[model samples]
Target: MGGEIKQIFEILETNARATPEQISTMTGIPAAEVEKTIKKAEKERTILKYKTAINWSKLGEEQVWALIEVKVVPQRGVGFDAIAERIYRFPEARSVYLVSGTYDLAILVVGKTMQEVALFVAEKLAPLETVQGTVTHFLLKRYKEDGEILEGEEGIKRLPVSP
Candidate 1:
């Protein structure tokens, strides 16, 4: 990648929704150049979709999330991809990762209530033939998400420094 491309990617990674004009100003590149670079990155799949972060807790809806460790038996002919595809079909599953630990997959799931999440695990996840076992851990609270602090502005306050 070109130096300009790398710089553009770094800026975009830091703030995905940054306007091309802002990027041009920050990186000292022309606005048209920034726009071209962003388009190229999108075409190359280096830049995914831009999205807004939301505080689900502030919306009067309880945010309950879980990390489910799934151990799966790869089918005789099929591979991990097949099993992964099946797991990703559930709307409750927010993210899925193939891991190197004892578990074959680590799935992040979110639900409105504890019971609803449990039902998903019991009725949907466990019944899959490929899935042998699963351990679910409900997140009590989140301190951060995607590098942004979620615990409000209190914890990050800086005290006065003496010279």
Candidate 2:
């Protein structure tokens, strides 16, 4: 990507609600060019979706989040892709990734309660033919998510200087 295009991507990534005109103003690019570039990016799947991150805990609607580590035996022809596709299709799965670690796949799942998340894992996730085992770790608290601080003030962190 050219500098202008990459700059546009960064600006949009920071604030998805930024209009093409706003981005053009910041980058000193023409608004029409910015709009055309954005349009092309969207068509090519470079710009996938604009999303909002909410801290639902503040609104008294807390969601139970779980990180499940899955060990799977890759299929002969398709390897892990087939099993990964199956895992990601579940509604409970918030994010699925093929990780480089002891586990084959890492899945982030969300539900109303702990039992609900456990039920999904028990009834849906762990039952796959290629799935060998699963280890689930429930999220107790979230201080930061998607580069945004969910609690306290968003400020620079530094150690106190002593001379």
Q: Indicate which candidate wins on lDDT.
A: 2
Clashing residue pairs in candidate 2 (N, C-alpha, C atoms within 3 angstroms): none
Instruction: Please list the residue runs of candidate 2 whose C-alpha ends up more than 4 Å from where it truly belongs after superposition.
Output: 155-163
Where in model 1 is the C-alpha error above 4 Å? 76-78, 152-163
C-alpha root-mean-square deviation, candidate 2: 4.1
* Candidate 2 structure, TM-score to reference: 0.92
RMSD of 1: 2.8
Put down candidate 2 lDDT per residue, 97-121, tens digits, no spaces: 9999899999999999999999999
**Lowest lDDT 10-residue stretch of candidate 1:** 153-162
Q: What is the per-residue lDDT of model 1 for residues 111-143, given as tens digits with 9 covering 90 to 100?
A: 988999999999999999889999999998888
- What TM-score would candidate 1 get against the native? 0.85
Error of 2 at 83 (Å): 0.2
Note the residue pairs that clash in candidate 1: none
RMSD of each: 2.8, 4.1
